[model samples]
Target: MELNILAVGDVVSPAGVKYLRTMLRKLKQQYCVDFCVVNGENAAMVGLTPSHADEILDAGADVITLGNHTWNCRDIVPMMEDCPYLLRPANFPPQQPGRGWGIFETKAGPVAVVNLIGRCDMAFGPDNPFLLMEKLLPQLDTKLILVDFHAEATSEKLAMGYHLDGRVSAVWGTHTHVPTADCQILPQGTGYITDLGMTGPARSILGVLPEQSVAGFRGELTSRFKAAPGPCKLEGAVFTIDTATGRCVHAEGVRIHEN
Candidate 1:
């Protein structure tokens, strides 16, 4: 008893969306993935008129998780609330706009997915996610659990992963555009990755204009950040989990270039 889960990093722009929409289904088929998830915080980064969060879902994503940039356009919050598949952040605050975690009915069973954020170097409220999960998780009745820990610091993300190991099926980190080298199944049968990376103009500086990023660092001036218009790349991973044992049999990272 198992399921194929493909978790993507951030989708940064229209090009990123187009590319992911074009390739994800094929990728899922090739990998025999059961469910697909993506971080859509940057889908409207380059532009906002064509907020294609739905388009990405139409393509194949079962769930789309967001981060602090989730509120970048201001229009997405309400829309996210209307849809359970699109999450802002669970650990945001009890009264926040969108839900932090949910369960989707699948052929395998109901898969519970939790969306959490880290406190270090991020806009997080006083609510402690570690405590919140401990309190709220038992109420859910799914053993095949997965989490997208969106955070800025690697240490905090790893800490949370370790804390939740053996309890959850997988814990994959996001928010950071760069994917880390660490992707492994925990001793307790939990799949872990420091970061899934972003699917965007990969050559740029973390999805932003390299020139602007460099100028801001070099000069004492505050520069308006923007996304770079160029070739894009998709970064994510497939967590092949053995449900009976709750261990990952296969852990592979993928990168698709818009060439």
Candidate 2:
């Protein structure tokens, strides 16, 4: 049987959550998605809040993954323990509040979702994701595994894809907020993408107002960053996996703009 999984990129701002509320279900229905995972670290102004997580879950996301900004909202630390479906980077110190991976029941059977953060150029400087995966994979009971690799460098994301090629069903990159055109099935049957882009304002700079982003880049004093107003766009990928073999048969990038 073929299982369709929809992996959404970082959700930024309240506008991003609004977009999901309006379109996520339609997207799932349109694609006949069997499972859905969303990177929601940016669901709030900087990091996700408990309410934002609830909003995404109510909007139809089956699993919510986070990255470096996982602790941006201090309140979410405790909420993580209560919400098993929400995952923080697995490489975080073992004492962290939330889990890095979990097996969830889906129409296609049990599917394992692992969340990891890249060490290169990251603020958290978590452990090596490649080595962490090597340790985690041996313990998972299901072959239908999906990984959300949140990193800044394209090289790191690509390296990870190759590192876990045949071992997981798919490895989708997040955090860059800009989508790449390299979605394809790896030589070993893993569906890979450099980045899934982001679900938020299409005109802004990584979901922040263009002027705000430019000010930061130009070394000019600027106020706190805020989500840009106006139309929002959703970016992600859909992977078609063969459940019997736990291999990706097809992968396609998804881009939707609010009409």
| Candidate of highest TM-score | 2
Q: Write the per-residue lDDT of candidate 1 for residues 1-259, one digit (tens) a residue.
A: 7799999998887878888888889889998989988888778873222258888899899998877776668767677668888876787767767788889987788888888877888644636778888987797787888899888899988898899888888899988889899888877778889999998887799888888888888975755778788888889999987877656777778877887
Name the runs in model 1 displaced over 4 angstroms: 46-50, 124-126, 220-223
Cα lDDT of model 2 by residue, 1-259, tens digit:
9999999999999999989989999999999998999999899968999999999999999999999999989999888998999999999999989999999998879999999999889865699899999899998999899999999999999999999999999999999999999999999999999999999988899999999999999999999998999899999999999999899999999999987
lDDT of 1: 0.82
Each candidate: RMSD? 1.9, 0.7
Residue 246 lDDT in model 2? 93
Model 2 C-alpha lDDT versus the unseen true structure: 0.95
lDDT of each: 0.82, 0.95
Q: Model 1 has how many clashing residue pairs?
A: 1
TM of each candidate vs. truth: 0.94, 0.99
Question: Candidate 2, after superposition: displacement of residue 12 in Å?
Answer: 0.4
